[model samples]
Target: MSPTIGAIVIPVSDLESAKKVYTALYGEPHTDQPYYVGFNVNGFEVSLNPQGEGGPVAMTDVDDLDATRNALLAAGATEQSAPRTVAPDVRICVLADSDGNPFGLRGK
Candidate 1:
């Protein structure tokens, strides 16, 4: 499947503060939870991740999460987290490139 950037996740130390800022910038969020907050701006998803360790991670959508994850691993990416269901009908996996840049793969 052709890859597409599904979401851009930002690491926020303070969830409430970040949420307020994002809310002002993107208007009301479609998703609001302790672990995550999500906003849709012009069809692009922007999310705040309170547990994120460092920089933002761009989640790419794939047709098959496992297959794409395996392919990325074979192509020199290291697994950071295995695929897991985050919400109903949504699954995601995290990986890091050779330079330790984190990214994610998402699928339904």
Candidate 2:
């Protein structure tokens, strides 16, 4: 089987609001809307699903979460949490769209 992160559908409270938040965060328009707002971030397929339809926050893996989070914020992505050390040589963090769905960032 081919194992890889393909796409995630996040449920937001509102599509328009989610669009604004995602656009500001991603710095681009969703591939499509009123259904799916898709984006490819660092090779990860991400789609913003409207509140009722969108499922949950889609988090991607990374090597340096602190640095990644810093970079994301610099790019206008909001930090849901600072880098949190979970285990030795490992940590995780979260970022969110304007509506508050939690997209996670992890490192080891």
Candidate 3:
């Protein structure tokens, strides 16, 4: 399957405060928890992570996580975080381009 830009996760210092602002713009979040607050903007996922470092990271949905990540690494991308499951049937990984700009990938 072709990759699709499915989600963008923003790292916030204060989740509650950020939740308020994001909720105002996007309405109430579909998923609200201590670790994350996720809003659905149209079909795209806009998420907030209290533990994340750096700025926002856009996640691309892929059919095969390992193959795609390996290919990216072969093409000069570096692994920032190895693939791990965040929720049921949902797995994600963080990677950086050669210049060290981080992005993410999500798969089932």
Candidate 4:
């Protein structure tokens, strides 16, 4: 078995809108394929999957979520809550982007 992520799937309300957002952020699309537009940058391989419910609330782990939270805040993301323990092995904080989709960052 592989010890790393095979890939990630992100769902979006509008494929066109998501494509534009991801393109601006990542700076390039991973593939020339027309159906999906995205690429692997940094550690994440982002793909915009068109679907109904919502995009992913990425659970990121960091040594200092307070700092990470601050960064995200400065970039226009809103803090839904401060970091708190959810389980013995989990501590997480919720955040929402300008579009109101919720995502979390966790620390061990």
Instruction: Give the number of the best model, judged by TM-score.
Output: 3
How many clashing residue pairs are found in candidate 1? 0
Off by over 4 Å in 3: none
TM-score of each: 0.94, 0.44, 0.97, 0.43
- Least well predicted 10-residue stretch by lDDT in candidate 2: 1-10
Q: Look at candidate 2 and tell me the lDDT of residue 98.
A: 68
lDDT of 2 by residue, 1-108 (tens): 222334455767777787788777776854765766777777666667563343465556676667777887887778756786844886656687666666776565
Alpha carbon deviation, residue 80, candidate 1 (Å):
1.1
Predicted structure 2, TM vs. truth: 0.44
- Which model scores highest in lDDT? 3
Query: Order of candidates by lDDT, top first?
Result: 3, 1, 4, 2
Report, for every candidate in turn, its global Cα lDDT versus the true structure: 0.92, 0.65, 0.96, 0.67
Tens-digit lDDT string for candidate 4 (1-108) = 212332355767678777878888888785735455557788675666564245455656666667777899999999876887845875667789898878777654
Spell out the clash pairs found in candidate 3: none
- Give the RMSD in angstroms, all C-alphas superposed, for model 4: 10.3
Location of the lowest summed lDDT over 10 successive residues in candidate 4: 1-10
Error of 2 at 101 (Å): 16
Q: Mind giving the per-residue lDDT tens digits that candidate 1 earns over 7-67?
A: 9989999999999999998899999999999999998899998998788989999998888
